[model samples]
Target chain A: MSIILDHVNYTYSSGTAYEIQALKDINIQIEDGQFIGIIGHTGSGKSTLIQHMNGLVKATSGAIYFNGQDIYDEDFDLRNLRTKVGLVFQYPEHQLFETTIFDDVSFGPKNQGLTKDEAGLRAFEALKMVGLDESLYYQSPFDLSGGQKRRVAIAGVLAMRPEMIILDEPTAGLDPKGRDEILDLISKMHDEKNITIVLVSHSMEDVAKYVQRIIVMNDGSVMFDDCPSEVFKHYKELEAAGLAAPQVTYLMHELKERGIDVDTEATTVEEAKRSILKALC
Target chain B: MLRDITLGQYYPADSVIHKLDPRVKLVGTLVYIVSLFLFKGPVGFLVITAFLALSIKLSKVPFLYMVKGLKAIMILMIITALFNLFLTPGETPIFTLGPLKMYPEGVKTAIFMLIRLSYLIVGTSVMTLTTTPNQLTDGLEKGLMPLSVIGVPVHAIAMMMSIALRFIPILIEETDLIMKAQMARGADFETGGIIKKAKNMVPLLVPLFVSAFRRADDLAMAMEARCYTGGKGRTKMKPLKYSGNDARAYLLTFVFLAVVIVLRIYNL
Candidate 1:
């Protein structure tokens, strides 16, 4: 029911002149129903790390276990693992291709060998779950708005009924409203479906608002893994890792430095407002 | 796996050949290809082989690395050899296979064709392996400068070539990303017949083309933002200059061409 990576290492173009060590000795454990945010600078191996979860990219060394089963075992079924651990890539709308939205959303369940009726039913449920209108089911996905197309892309993954869904920068290239709407939908999915959610993002504000825990990556290694309050407390180290705490955390720290008694660990604006009000009162 | 392709890949190194002017290397490759065709017999091959071996050695690229380029054209080489082996009419029949006869002169022609093709590839690989794409384009623009007098847009052609070369790696990486995204959605690209495989490619190609057009639009906008109005009166950051090493290279090329010409005259 949990995923564990033990001493994972990956190198791109190994043994060639272009060889690059993309991941180095990564070791982490992801528990069931946990909402985790993976934060890192570009090239810090966030994408490579997530890809290894479902065997999209094989590790040069070490192993990954899904609920006590070694995924890289000779007899392990990778396709089944992929069905269970759904991945929504960055700019996922770009991967959409179907004559109609319903078929596009059904692509995943149908690939799992579901009958047309079963797949269609799953697609219908997934579309509704993503908040898509029933009318758009018969329309071309290309004709939808960017945000709507992205919802369809995510619905495609949800139709598989995966226990865990990992999204890589899911809000990228979306408007601020679209970003909040998408994040809200993702949070609702985790709460209602009881699904494990791993969000890889560069936005500290979004992660601070929704994710229960944060994993900070630096130079292909995990630098921190803890609750949001504890992780944001290491703002200096995080900056060294090429990231910053949420802006409110910095503001709270500044208030404290100015001799006001405020908790610097407040990462969200609401938390900062409460802390600042308490200190003033 | 797609990244394994090393076409027009330059090997970074510091050596005599790398230091030589790119124009000289470009012309040297042309001369070498011409010399390969000029060979008439084993003696001429000896001369050509010696010249090619010397150039490759000076370039400092590993022999294995240079020869790896041959793998790409292996099918073409084999097809040419097979055509020569089965189609050439000769007096002596060496072997027979199911109504097809191999002749002695056919064997000779096949061997000659294989040698010529391999030597040409190796020689050209040496040139490209030593010269960076930027330097090669610069050399081409400079070499074709004379053509501008007759109304050829040499600068624009060179600029286009460099841009195309730059986009190759970007497009490859994009294609790999798009493929992985589709694969995650359970789009099985492999494990299908030819037609099914092509049909599967629709998911990959449509997005690739859209992104490519978007990228082109962005690049054009960025170029315009920088006030780039096509290569009119553009000056080089590092102008091409012939140095001592280039002079030596030219002298060596002169001798090699002379030897090849004399060998041709003697019909060797």
Candidate 2:
């Protein structure tokens, strides 16, 4: 396992008037090379839980272990731990401070004490990994469009080359084309690099199409943890938890409820189309 | 790191101070601060302190919150007092320490200055704790309307202040998010020397500045779309007017100021 959270509990603004229990008793194991999607409504503790994997947030009561070592141990080097488990926050371009794109992407590896030449090579490689052109590396990051800026921010993290990458709502606020482009880049990173990918998203369609496994959270608790198809099968429960099944699954379910002979378990449009054609035949 | 800011935080309560019109509260605060400078002797200080305590009680604001606010400025307060104690000359010296002499006049001046500053801070804090930022801006614009005859843009200035106050918490939240995002990328801010820590701010500051500009541009466009053009011929939905209660409150403050001025001249 690359990351394991053991009965974790996290509270925001603890001991203040605004104290809120964000996560409660969250226990899960994320294996290396697994593509996992975390689905939840707003403020369901998905962001808080992912922040724990890299020691950004210490558990209020329990523990988090990374690669079989307790990350919160006194002797643990938390900086090294962060480099190993990269986290890209939502709308991460807001953290961009460097004058040029190349310098921004090289920030992580340089901080890790990599030699200039090595860090440059890593930054170049990371930018290419996200489909940014080499010619634009020297241009100011402020010149980039919204989608390109997002990619540059991700490359800033990818330059460190972590074993696991956790992204919180990475595709948020992007148009559909931009969202798909970023999603495809993430999928390629997971497949080609064999990296553990934990994607936090609110879109059922995206989770159904890309992720191998899904974890659903509701009101500071894990509602379901299973394969995407299996989790989507509990459509009513998911809906009650403020999440909807993918459109294909929803349409199939509606058809099934209306006396059509179709498999309501279909999670993708292709599968739903095939089932509908079969039912018509 | 920027999450600890408590500015513009109004604690909701149903007390006499909270119920007062914001304009009344604003004028009352100004009068109280002026009285602090006008008062002379321990009797005047004692009277003002008592008034402060009663106002705090009436406002239903926690005493500890005011103490916390004072603690933030304790170092500056102490420096001011120490400077006065060592510098002011008097007829008789109270103490001498390594070429620094503390005179009775210096001690009296320091104590009075400290008490005056403290009371001023607490009185203004009471106004902020009771009035929301929107209400405060409304009161400010109404109070400054007389400046319009001199060609001053009072409404525009008040609008700017109101917007800035509203965005303080939002900017703080954005800064917190940016810090966490950089920290996740291995930026260490806690363990470095001042220079190194400043260098660490590169990643955090770049993004924050960029986002701030973007937000500003977006806000400008949004405001333009709503036809917001510099407050000319603008009418307010809630026009500020003084009621009978406001007149009574202003009268009470005037009497308090008169008493403080009388005590100062008589030295009693």
Candidate 3:
């Protein structure tokens, strides 16, 4: 119930004039029931990293082990691994193709060789899991609003009942309210299922608010892998790498500069508020 | 895996061939095709081969890269050669196989036709593999500028061509993403029966078409916002101009054609 990437390296367009080393000597272990956030700017290989988890992309050099089985072995069941590790891509709404929302969600379960009726049942549960209304089940997925469409796409992945779920920028191009709703839905899924959740994002605040541990990547290598509070302590280094700490982290730093004896590593609004109030007292 | 498609692929280089005006390369290719028809005997073929070898050397593109494009047409070349080997009537019979007899003329023509087809392909590759899509469309628009007077819409045609070329890589990238997304949904594209594989493509194609249409709509709106009127009285940011290299290239092309024509006249 875990995934390990051992000494992985990936090269895009290898041996060509336009070749690029996308990932270099990466090693990571993702254990069950851990909610982790992978934060990096675009082209920082975050997308490439997640694609490897589900056997969607093979590493040029190195091996990935899922649940203690080498994924690249001669007889490994990649399709079975795909069922266990669901990946929700960025702009997932674009992947919806079925005439009805329920059918589209059931696509994943059906692909896993479930009976049509069984798949439909799983799809129904997945739709409910994403908090979509029962009335919208039979409607065409294309007719749904943007947020609803995204929810259906996520349910498509969820119907497989994966042990782990990886979301790549699930909130991209969404309104602020939609973003909060999706993030909250993801957090709820993590809490209820106790699944290994890998949230790939570029926003510092989004990860800080939801994930327990943070993996900060810069130019294809991991810069920090620790708890959110500890990762934010290196705000200067993060800023130098073209990423910023959350706004509340900056607020705490300013308070500290003004001689307030507050903890500077508070990553969220609530933590920062408590630290500031305690310091004032 | 889809990257193997070398359709309209341009190989970047800093050689004289690459730096020449695209119009020059286009004309040079035309002249080379014409010369391929004028050659006669072994001497003519040798002359043509030497000229082609020199041009390839000066182009600085890898020989292996240029030849990779031949793989697609290899079957056609072999078929044509085989046909020539069996059917052509000649005074001398060189060999026989079962019910078929091979003539010396058949052998010569087969070898010649094979060489001609290969050279034709390699010659055109020199033009396309060197000229970028933008430059190619620019060359086409300018070369056919005379037709604009007859209401041929030359500029519009070139604009369509350039836009299509620009979208090729973009569409390829989008297809890659959509395919991966579908694959993650447990869609097995590989290891399926033909009918099953075709059915599996539904997920990939649907999303690709959706995104492409969305992108087209956005592009159209953006173009309208910028007041992009049709190409009447429009000026290019990078205008086409011939250089000393282009002049020499034209002269060399004419010389090659003249030599081939002279060889045909002498029957040598």
Candidate 4:
């Protein structure tokens, strides 16, 4: 249950005047059940890199393997592989096509060749997993609020019961409460289902609170792939890449620089508070 | 799949044709098309082809791109030629195949038809290759100003055309994204019969239509908020005026048209 990208490269608008090299040679392996957070500046190819995981975008000049099998091989069932590695794109609510929430959620499971009853059952359970009420299942997806629509989109993917899920900027354009609600829901999905999660984010604070492992991308290549604490240690490097460490991590580092015997690796505010209290004692 | 549409897509270039007034180009295209239909024999077709080549050169658009555009309508051109060659009644029999006879008149008509259609396409291509969509819309609004006296609402029509042109590339890009999103959810769009293929389009088409309407609604609201009130009493930031060069160009086109009309009248 691991994904490996070996020397992958991607170019946009290939063979045209507007051709752009979006990703250089990139190599990384994501182990099973790892809650990986990916961060990069806009246009740094973070989105492109994640898309390769589920065969959404084929690598221009390299290979991707799912659990040690080359996904691009002629015999490989890309459709089935996609179901095993669900991807919820940014503003995924815009992809909702069905009339009702129930229909939208059932779309994925139905495509997987499940019985109608089984698909319906999974759709209800997936909606429940995303904290959506069963009564709302019959309601028009267009009538739902922005946040609810977003959740329904995620539930649509979850209904397929993928082993891994990748989300690109899931919390973008949301209010603070909406952001927290989505982050909490994702964390719950990861913990309860033990599904591998790849979260592509621009916000340091959100990734800090939710992700266990961090993969920092810069200019279409992986700069760091480590636990959140290890990756945040290179705060200066992250800043140079047009990214920042989480606020709490920055504060902890500032305290450490001021001769406080506090752990500089604390990612969340609560963890930072504990570090501070330990240092005070 | 919608990305394959390349009609009226501007290729940015720095050339004299790109700098020409859109209205001049538009009128020139109209004259050129009229000349194409007026021309009868090979000599007139040669002259029109020469003019097309010169315009293509001035535009600095790749010749291969024009060929690519022609390729899209290749089947139509071939079918028209075949229809004329096989069906047209003529006196001079060139050959006989069992009961069917081929006539020199039919061959002449087929070749002439092909040349006429090619010229029409090339003339229009010159107009689109040189002008940006915005400039074209502006030209259209100005060109159709005379119709406004008949309550045509020319400005509104031009505005709609401009907005539609602007959103075409955007909508195509969005469709690509949605297709990928659904494909990642194991929705198979390929490897199906015609009916199954169309049924598979439900996921892609529904989302695309939904997003398009959402974008249109939002755009309308934004425009209304910014005091866009149906182009009433609107003044242009870049007002269009005919130059001396435009007059000269128009005169040249008129002379060309006169020559074509003479050829047609004399059956030359």
In candidate 4, which residue pairs clash? none
| DockQ winner | 3
Expressed as tens digits, the lDDT of each residue in B48-91 for candidate 3 is 88888888899898887778778889999999999999999888
Q: In candidate 3 chain A, where is summed lDDT lowest over 10 consecutive residues?
A: A11-20
Comparing 1 and 2 by lDDT, which wins? 1
* TM-score per model (chain B): 0.95, 0.92, 0.86, 0.90
TM-score of each: 0.92, 0.93, 0.93, 0.92
Clashes of each: 0, 4, 0, 0
lDDT tens digits, residues B46-160, model 2? 8788778888998887786665567666788899999999999887777999989999989888998888777777778899878989999999898888998899999999999
Measured against the true two-chain complex, the DockQ scores of the candidates, in the order shown, are 0.53, 0.65, 0.74, 0.69
lDDT of candidate 1 over A236-271, digit per residue (tens):
999988899999988998999999999888888998
Best by TM-score: 3
Q: Rank the candidates by TM-score, best first.
A: 3, 2, 1, 4
What number of backbone clashes does candidate 2 have, counting pairs of residues 3 or more apart or in separate chains? 4
Cα deviation of B92, candidate 2, in Å: 5.1
- lDDT score at residue A261, model 3, on the 0-100 scale: 97
User: Which tens-of-lDDT digit does each residue in A1-281 have in candidate 4?
Assistant: 99999999999867655667888989888889989899999999999888899988888999999999999999998899999999999999998989899999999999999999999999999999999887899999989999999999999999999999999999988999999999999999899999999999988889988888888889888898888989998999999999999888878878889999998878899999999999999
Q: In model 1, how large is the Cα lDDT of residue B84?
A: 99
- Consecutive 10-residue window with the lowest summed lDDT within model 1 chain A: A13-22
Candidate 4 wrongly placed segments (more than 4 Å): B91-119, B241-259, B262-268
Which ten contiguous residues of candidate 2 chain B have the minimum total lDDT? B1-10
